[model samples]
Target chain A: MNVVLLDPSEVRADGGASLDGRRAEHVAKVLGKAPGDALAVGVRGGKLGSAQVVSSTKQALELEACVFEREPAPKRPITLVLALPRPPVFRRLLQHVTALGIERIVLLHTRRVEKSYWMSPSLEPAAIDTQLQLGLEQAVDTVAPDIERARGFKAFAEDRLPELAAGARVLVAHPGPFGPCPVDVPGPVVLLVGPEGGFIPYEIERLTEAGAQGVSLGPRILRVETATLALLGRLGG
Target chain B: MNVVLLDPSEVRADGGASLDGRRAEHVAKVLGKAPGDALAVGVRGGKLGSAQVVSSTKQALELEACVFEREPAPKRPITLVLALPRPPVFRRLLQHVTALGIERIVLLHTRRVEKSYWMSPSLEPAAIDTQLQLGLEQAVDTVAPDIERARGFKAFAEDRLPELAAGARVLVAHPGPFGPCPVDVPGPVVLLVGPEGGFIPYEIERLTEAGAQGVSLGPRILRVETATLALLGRLGG
Candidate 1:
């Protein structure tokens, strides 16, 4: 873990935090932290700071957090609307997008997406939280990303997408004669990426009519996770 | 598999090829190819073409390879010099870089790299080939990337790096006061990335002295794989 994160409930009124379970084990074993050593710490939805270890044992660990400047990580201006990837890929994309500082994610349904993917346990709130937490920890950020699911492609494109992308430029990543994915795009963007076989022609036309412009990522086909990262990076995330 | 790849040994003298095992299963079960159905195929280090399924059975499959085109995927002009990542990360990275069309990879030893990482079975030629094949299949590329290992950081930095990076812009990915990585650069580049904890100051100094200019990817810390993809994408890979 790049940073140790604690929830508000875990901290005492005196600014001291008692860490147990996974946190304690990580601090004791993986980090090899000792009393008096300062570790990078952050409160969920709060400030980032350092915590001095007060005492440590196999059972529990204690820390006295000294709040410092409240500087958050760079915010990603892009809102990702992605066709829900397969379960294995979904897990990595969650961690990757979070680490890259994507503020919001919309798990979209497209024609090529398998219906079974929506039933995977990886979409559970707790499982997603765990992956996002790892990403937040990696980026040393306190704010968690907002995630939502859209089960109907047409309804999402014709209804919800227009609202979500009202003030943002909407771009759909597709492989074709469309303009190349722009680099260092300024301001907010709502990026839509499709499933493995890509969006059906009807779905693409619907999204295009909904104000999403198609963009290509050159000739080689990249996996959904890689393509997402590549687009985010190109947009200066 | 997006593309079925056949090595020269698999192709008969008359340009007919027999497939079995994994390739056969992928063609039959996954892609559901039948007689007279044409699938995208490529010969290793050769032309991209279409292979018509001539026959299919549970035990084996047959195809008539029509070498139609010499078009390979767009080439990635960047050569990657990366510290050996952890086993799982290494496997994914190999696949990712190959999919992104990176043709050369040099696995370097650095201060933060664990000694055991060098001993991973994932580094074996056969294992590496498997991962690269998966990537080529995903991208529909026929050529496999060249991979090398450098055991001594100092020696490699002082000796081989200068020669390998000759005539190419040498950019090192470091999280510091360096300028943001360049976008859409025209020409070949040799990109260096560090291990998990990152390269020490001494290693950075050595690389800088050896003609590598450090570049940043903004504030948030990204995993090595993410950073690599981000930089490559920004560079118009």
Candidate 2:
């Protein structure tokens, strides 16, 4: 982890904090940090800062008051609408998009998305928090992305997507004879990416009717996580 | 796997072939192909085609002569120059770049690159081929990316990079003050990316002196794989 993240609740009014479990283990084993060593630290949904190790032990790592450095990195103006992938793929994409500083995520359901994927335990709140936290840590950012689920394509397209994407340019990442994906878009965007085999024609049509323009990233299909990062990267102005 | 890839040697003079082991297991268990089923197939570094399963058994899966359908997808006009990442990261990057149709790769040794990464089994020719094959299958493309290793940054920057990147725009992905990465360049490019903590100031200076213009993907620090895909996606025309 690039930055040590502590939940707001963990920080005492005196600014002292104690960390155990994974964070402690990572600080001790991976970082080989000792007491008095200053490390980059950030509060959950707070500011970036530095924390000096007060004490280190097998059970926990203690830190003194944080010296706030600066505000979190600016958030990307992108709302990712992705068809739910297999659990393993979902885990990686969550961390990647989060690290890229995405503003929001909508796990969508489409015809090509396997029904079994939604049953995965990775969709649980705890599991998602763990992944997004990893992303925030990787980027040294303090803001956590907001995630929502859209269980049905038609319902999401007709009811929720249009409103959620009302002021944003909505684009779907599709293959075949579509216009190329936009580059370095400076404004807010709602980008819809499909599952493994891609959204069926009917799903694409519905998304198109919902004000999303179908765009291609070229002929070679990329995995979900790769595509998400690529799209985000392309739109990063 | 999107397409079953066969080494050129696997195709007999008459174009018929038999496959066993991993590919057979995949066709049998994952794809559930039976005798007389036609499946998409491609020749390594060659063409895309279809193979009809003539026979199926526990030991081997036999196929009739392939009817070549088309040439492989056009290669991406880009070559990646990256610092050697950890082995696990290397594996994913190999597959990702291959799926994105990178024309070539040069894994360089830089100040931040851990020397231990050179000894990884993932760097072995066979192991690298396996990952690249997976990428080719995933993208339904037949060209396998050519990979090279540059043991020292200086040697690579002076002795080889100038020549290899001749006639191509060479841009290095760095985090600090630099111009934004280019998008949709309709020409060949040699993109350089750094290892984990990123290239030190001296290393970046050397790369800058070597015809590489340092470019930023903005403020959010992306992992090596994410940065690589984003750069590639941004440059995809």
Candidate 3:
């Protein structure tokens, strides 16, 4: 873990904190910290600070806080409009986007998406939060990106695209052609990636009509999960 | 697996072949192939053919080959110059690039690369072959990308860059003020990506002076593995 994350509730009135569960286990087992050892800590939605180990036990560890440093800015201002993938793929995407520090995520539906995928247990709020948390831990950051779900493509394009596209670069990844996805895009961007089979031709046309630019990754097709990361990496790299 | 891959020696004069060990296990356990079942098979450095199961045993399976079909041309002609990553990450990258249908991979040295990485067991020819086969199987292609290692940066750049850059688009990935990686590159490309911490400023300068266009993926930094996929996806997509 790059940084130890603490929830607001974990903070004591006198600038101290205690960790339990996974965090405690990580400190004891992975990091092998003992009393008096120093650990990097960050408060959720807050700043980063150094924590001095005041007490240690197998189940929990108490720490005294030092000063807080300004947190790094979150990743570029981008909104990812993704087609829901299989549960395993979704879980990995969540962690990846979180680690990359995306600002927002909109999980949407497309023609080829299986209806059953929406019912996956992995879509539970707690499950999503857990994966996002893992991403934050990996990046040593504490900020959480806002995530929303769109039930229909038309509704999202008609109802949300106008406002979302305002003053933002809109790029949609698809197979056919419009030219390659640009490398160093400036300003805010909205990246739309389709399902496994990809967005239908009609859907691509509609998105393009709605001001989204059609962009290709290259010649060979990629799995939805891999494509998402590839888009982010290229656009954000 | 999308396509079954066979070694050059696997093809018999009578067009009959048998698979043992891992291939046999995969056919029996994963694919659940039975006698008389048809399977897509590709011979290394040859053509794709249809194979019909002739007999099956616990330890081996025999097949009868039919006609061969010419394999499709590579999606794009891109040669990847990568810094060696960890074993697990390296394995994943090898498979990923193969799935993307890349034809060549050159693993090079950079300042941040750990010397110990050269000793990884995953670097063995057989092990590397296994990973490449996984990629070939996924893409259902018969040709395997060539993988080479470059131990000295300055020496290789001086001795190889001139000829390697001939008649090909060359781009180096780095963070900073470069424009986004261009999409729909017109010709063949030789793309370069640095190790985890990234190539030092001097290294990037050297590459740029040697005729590489410096480019950025985006604002957020990505892990080396993620960056590789992203670079391929954008360049190939």
Candidate 4:
């Protein structure tokens, strides 16, 4: 864990907390923290700061004090609209984007998205929370992104995407003879990345009608997971 | 497979080839290619072309005609120097960078890198080739990267790095009070990324002494794989 992140409820009224499991193991072994050493700490959806280790053990770490001095980690003004990938890939995608600081995520349905992907256990709330926590831990951030599922491509294109793209720079990452993905975008951006096979022509038209301009990542076709990170890095950087 | 890649020996004198394996499965089911269908094909480390499927079954595909007119996929002038990641992560990293068009890769040993990582079966030549081929298939590319193992950090930094960094924009990705990574670079670049925990101060100093200019990715700490992709997209874009 880059930084110890705790839920608000985990901390006592006096700003002390005790953590066990992976975080504790990280503190005890990976970080090799000793008693009285200050450990970087943050609360989920809250402030960032440091906490003093009151006690440290292989499986547990107790914090005697915490001081919230700085604001939470910054969130990128980017919302990722991804066609549900394979279950294994989806897990990694969640962690990757979450680490990259995407503020919102939309699990979208496109013509090429497999129907069975929606049934994967990776989408369960608790399972997703685990992945998001892993990302936050990796990035040393505490902000959890809001995630939504858009099950119907037509409904999402006609009813929701237009509203989402009204003021945002909506770019659909499609392979074609088109412009490059923009960098250092000024405002909010809603990026739609299709499934592995890519968006069919009809689906691309629907997305375009929703205000997303088709953009080529490059000549080489990229996996959705890698493509998402590349886009976020360029856009957010 | 976005593009089917075959070894030179696999193609017969008449330019016909039969494949029965994962590639065949992809061609049969995922692509749903029928008899006389033109499939995008490439010779590994050779030409990019198309092959006409003479017959297709769930487990095998036979090609009766082949045309290789186009050049191989382009390779970026970026050489990556990475502290070998965890075994599972390494498999993905190799494929990731290969797909991103890195021309050369050096898997280096750093102070923080675990000694046991060198013993991973994933490093076997056959295993490495499989990952590279998968990456080539993913990106529709035929070029493969040359990867080297640098067992000693000091020797690499002193004996080898000076020559590698010579006349190249060498940037070592390290967290520090350093400048942002450059974009739209004029020439070749050699990028060195550290282990998960990061390179120690002494290692960073040695790298700097060897002519690497330190650059920060951003505020957030990123996994080596994600950081590498982000850098490639920015530098190669």
Candidate 5:
């Protein structure tokens, strides 16, 4: 773990706080923390602090944490408008985007998206949260990306695209004949990535008309998850 | 497996050819091939063929094969020069590049590359070959990418690059002040990507002087593997 993240509710009534269960196990085994070891800790939506381990056991550990400074927000402002992918890929994509500290994510539906993907057990809120948490941990950041779901491309383009694109640089990833995607564009960007088969011509037209510029990643086709991570990495860099 | 790839020896063999061990297990269990099932197969340097399963068992299987036609070479010619990554990531990157039908891969050494990484057990030739085979199978291509090791950057850039870039477009991926990476660039390309911390300024300068154009995937810093795949996807597309 890059940084240890704690939930606000985890703090005990006393000044001393105990980390139990998986977190405790991670600390004891993976981190190999002993009594009096200083651990980097952050409270969700709160400030970061150095926690002094007071006692340790196989199942739980206690720490004395002092409130410190708040973690900084992400450097770049990024919002992803992605068509939902298969469950396994979605899980990896979520963690990767989170690690890169993206500001927001909008999971939209497209014609090519399989209906069964939406109903996957992996899409559960708790599971999604876990993936985001992993991303935050990887980047040593405290902010969690805001994730929203959209049911249809038409509705999202007609209703939500205007609002989302009002002040952001919008780019849509399609496999057609478009110029190279620009690197290091200034200001916030709203990136749209289609499902496996890619955005249909009509969908591309609608997004383009709604202020999204069609961009190409290159010639060879990439899997949905690979494309998402590549776009995020390229755009975020 | 998207395609079945066989070594040159396997192809030149006469009747009663046996596929033992893992290949046998995959054919019998995973692919559910029984006696007389027709399977698409390709010999490493020979021809694509349709093979009929003669006998099947968990541990071994035999096939009667007939040569058909050679699998065509990949359309876009691209070579990847990457600073080796961590073991797991390196394995995945190999498969990914293979899936995209890259022609060559040169694993180079860079300052940021951990010395311990070179000693990784995963770097064994057998292990590397397995990963490459997996990629070849996924792309349904018969040609195997030539995998080579470059000891150092200066030597490779000064001695080897001239011949490597004889008539190819050479692009170096850097997250600096470069414009978007070009898509649909015709002709052969030698894409260079740095390790985790990226190539040092001097390295970038040297590469640029050596006829490599600096290209950016955008502002976001991507992991080495991600950057490689992204560039391949965009360039190949």
Candidate 6:
């Protein structure tokens, strides 16, 4: 863990807090901190700063006080629209995107997306938080990404997408004869990535009608996770 | 598997080849290919095309004929110099980077890296091949990436790096007050990445002395896997 991240409620007004569980274990073992050692700390949905270790043990740690005074990493102006993948893939993607500093995520089921994926326990709120928190700690960021589930492709594309992507350049990544994916796009980008086999032809047509340009990532096909990071990285000016 | 990759020796002069093991199992089960069904096929370090199944059983298949006429994905020009990570992370990275079409990987040890990481089974040839082949299958590429072992930081930087990095722009991804990493660097690139805790000051200094420029990947710290993808993605013009 790069930073010790805690919910705002976890810290008292006096800037003191008690931490246990994974974070505590990380402090006790990975970091091997002694009492009075200053630690990098951050408040969820808030700023980043430092805190002093008041007491320490194998399973828990107490902070004498906390002071979150620095701003976290700048949030990227991107909204990721991803087809729900298998549970394991979904979990890893969640953690990676969160670490990359995305502010919003829209999870919708494409035609090829297995319906079983939505039933995955990884979609649970607590499980989702665990992955996102891991990301926040990894990137030393505080803004938890807002995740919205827009049931299926048609509903999301025909009803919700038009308005949601109004001022943003929406790009759907698919293989075909199309322009190369844009790099260093200015302003906001709504990147839509499909399932493993890619969005069906009709689905791509619908997305095009919804004002998203189909962009090819070349002949080399990448896994959705790799493509997501690559697109975001290339687009992040 | 995107492409059924076979060694040149696997195919005869008459274009007949019998596949067993995973590829055969995939054809019999995952792909459900029937006799006379054509499947995309490629030869390692060679061309990509299709093959027709002449016979299929639960565990093996016979190809009536194989033809390789198409080229695989264009090989990328980046060479990655990574500080050895814990085994599991290294395995995932090996797969991910290979899928990204990297042609060369130079694994080395840095001060922050644990000595035991070198003893990992993941470093074994067969184990490494498993990961690389996974990437080749994922990207539908036929070429296996070349792996080089640069055992120690000092020796590699002082001895090997100078000549290997001579004409290429060598950029070390390190966090600091350095300028932003250059994107789409012209020609060849020898990109060096440090281990999790990052290279100590002295290592960074020696790297700089070896004609390597330190480039910052911005404030957000990314795991070596994510950062590798991001850097290579942004640099792959």
lDDT scores in order: 0.88, 0.89, 0.81, 0.88, 0.78, 0.88
Say which docking band candidate 1 falls in: high
> Model 3 reaches what TM-score against the true structure?
0.72
TM-score of chain B of each: 0.97, 0.96, 0.95, 0.97, 0.94, 0.96
Query: Quality of candidate 6's docking, in CAPRI categories?
Result: medium
lDDT of 2 by residue, A25-122 (tens): 89999898998999899988988999889987667999996776689888888999999999988998898889989999999988888899999999
Error of 5 at A187 (Å): 1.4
lDDT of 6 at B69: 98
Q: Tens digits of per-residue lDDT for model 4 on A104-193?
A: 999998878889989888999999999999999889889989999999999999998987887899999988998877777879999999
lDDT tens readout by residue for model 1, B99-184: 99986999999999999999999999999999999999998899878898999999999999999888889999999998988998
Q: Candidate 6 at B151: error in angstroms?
A: 1.0
TM-score of each: 0.98, 0.95, 0.72, 0.96, 0.67, 0.97
Worst 10 residues of 2 chain A by lDDT: A65-74
Regions of candidate 3 where Cα sits further than 4 Å from its true position: A32-37, A55-58, B1-71, B74-88, B103-130, B137-141, B148-222, B231-237
Which candidate do you rate higher for DockQ, 4 or 5?
4
B83-146 per-residue lDDT for model 3 (tens digits): 8887888887888787777778999888989899889999999999888887777666777898
lDDT of 6 by residue, B86-132 (tens): 99889988988899888789998899999999998899999999999
Best by DockQ: 1
Q: Every model's DockQ, to 2 decimals?
A: 0.80, 0.77, 0.30, 0.67, 0.17, 0.71
The number of the candidate with the highest lDDT is 2
Which stretches of model 6 miss by more than 4 angstroms?
A: none
Candidate with better lDDT, 3 vs 6:
6
Tens digit of per-residue lDDT, candidate 1, span A84-183: 9999999998988888888799999888899999999999999999999989899888888799999998789889999988888899999889887888
As for DockQ, the candidate ahead, 1 or 6, is 1
Q: Scored by Cα lDDT, where does model 5 land?
A: 0.78
In lDDT terms, how accurate is model 2? 0.89
Model 1: CA > 4 A from native: none
